[model samples]
Target: MERMDGVPPEGEGLKGGTHRRTDGQVGQWRGVFSPGGGLQPLLPPPGPPQPLPYFVRRSRLHNLPVYPRLRKSNRRLTELRHVEGDIWALERELRAFLGGRGGKEPEVQVNEVTGSLRFKGRWEGELREWLLQRGF
Candidate 1:
C-alpha cells in the first residue's frame, strides 16, 4: 500500500482500501482505516449470551407458562409442563383432567392449522378447575 501524504480523498484510506461513508454507504474495498491508518476488521469480537429479563426468569422458576421457546419443544394439546411435582405425576394429572387423552376428543374442537381449541359444551370437574388455575 502506498503511504499517504495528506488527507485522503473520500473513500480512499492510507492502506489503499475503502472506508464506509458517514451517509451509510460503503466503498470499493469494504475495509475501514484505524486512527493509525491500519485497516480495522468490520466485525467485533463475540460476547456471552445476555440474561433473560427478570420477569421471564421468575416465570420459569415458578413453573409458569412463559415464552414458547422456554417450554418443552414437543408439547401436545393437553400436555402442560408447568404444574408442580414430578413430570410423570403432572402428566398423569393433566391426562386425567383432559379426559384420558392428549388431543381434543369428542367435546372440544381443535383447529388443526391454528391450534385453537373450542369447547362445544361446558367444561366440568377437574378440567374446569385446571383451566381456571392457569388463568385461561
Candidate 2:
C-alpha cells in the first residue's frame, strides 16, 4: 500500500520517523534528549513562587491620614474621607499597591475639591485592613 505522498505505508526508507524510545517511556517528550541516548539535565527547577506584597509586613502611612468609609448607593464605592494630605498622591500610591498585589487595579475617582477619593468597588475590608496595618 502507498500513502498520498507515494511513500510506502510500511514506512520503508523513512528516516527519523516517530518511534517508541528504547527507554519505554510514553507520552509527549520533555527536555533535551542527546544523541548519546542519555537525557540531559532539564533546566534548573524554577524558583519558589513569589508572594504578593500585600502578604508582607505593612508599612506605616506617614503624614497621610486615610479614613476609608464604605458608601453604597446605586454602586458600591470606598470613600476616603478626612484625608489630611494630597488625595491624588494617595490615589497613585493605592493604585501601585493594588497593582503589586497581582489583582486588577480598581478605578478611582478623585474629587480634588472635596478632598476625597472614590474607589470603585466594595473594598471596605481591604481598605480597612490596609489602613489598620498602616497604623491608622
Candidate 3:
C-alpha cells in the first residue's frame, strides 16, 4: 500500500478506495491532478447563498388606539401616526372598506398636512381590523 507513482497498485484494480485507475493502461490515475495537469473532480467547496423564508403575520391589533407603523423608509409603506380626527374622513372610510373587500383598492395616502395615513401595501392587519371595527 505504498506505491504512488501513477497510483493503481492497491488491490490490483482497487474498486472502493476510489483512487480510480481500473487498469485500462495509458496514463492511468483518474482524478486529483490539477496544477494545470487537468483532472480535478473531488467536489465539496461551495457554500453561502440561502435566505428566503419570510412568514411574519400575526398582529390583529389588540387593545387598539390606532398604532399602525411599519414604514422603515418605505418597506411598501403602512404608516398612520398620531392621526387624531378626520384624516380625510379616515381616508374615505379606508377606501370604502377596501372597496368592499373584493380586490384592487389599496393605496390610501392622505397626509392632509401631516395627519398621516399612507397605507400602500402591507395594510397592518387589515388596517388594525378596520380600526377595531370602527370603535377606535
lDDT of 2 by residue, 17-107 (tens): 2334457643232233344544343342256533332221212322233344546566667776656455666678777876676779999
Tens digits of per-residue lDDT, candidate 3, 31-116, equal 34344543444432256422322111222322343344555774576776556555676677678887788887887777667566
Give every collision pair in model 3.
none
Sort all candidates by lDDT, best to worst.
3, 2, 1
- TM agreement with the true structure for every prediction: 0.22, 0.44, 0.20
Q: Where is model 1 more than 4 Å wrong at Cα?
A: 1-84, 100-131, 134-136
lDDT of 3 at 11: 30
Please list the Cα RMSD from the true structure of every candidate, rounded to 1 decimal place. 18.6, 20.0, 21.8
- Give the alpha-carbon lDDT of every model: 0.39, 0.53, 0.54
- Which residue pairs collide, candidate 1? none
Q: Supply candidate 2's per-residue lDDT for 113.
A: 74
Q: Pairing residues by index, what is the TM-score of model 2?
A: 0.44
Question: Given candidate 3, what's the lDDT at residue 13?
Answer: 28
- Superposition error at 15 for model 2 (Å): 92
Best by lDDT: 3
Model 1 C-alpha lDDT per residue in residues 1-136, reported as the tens digit of each score: 3223322444554333455656667554434566576555443225543332111111322232422222257432332223332334433444466665454633443343432333333343444456445343
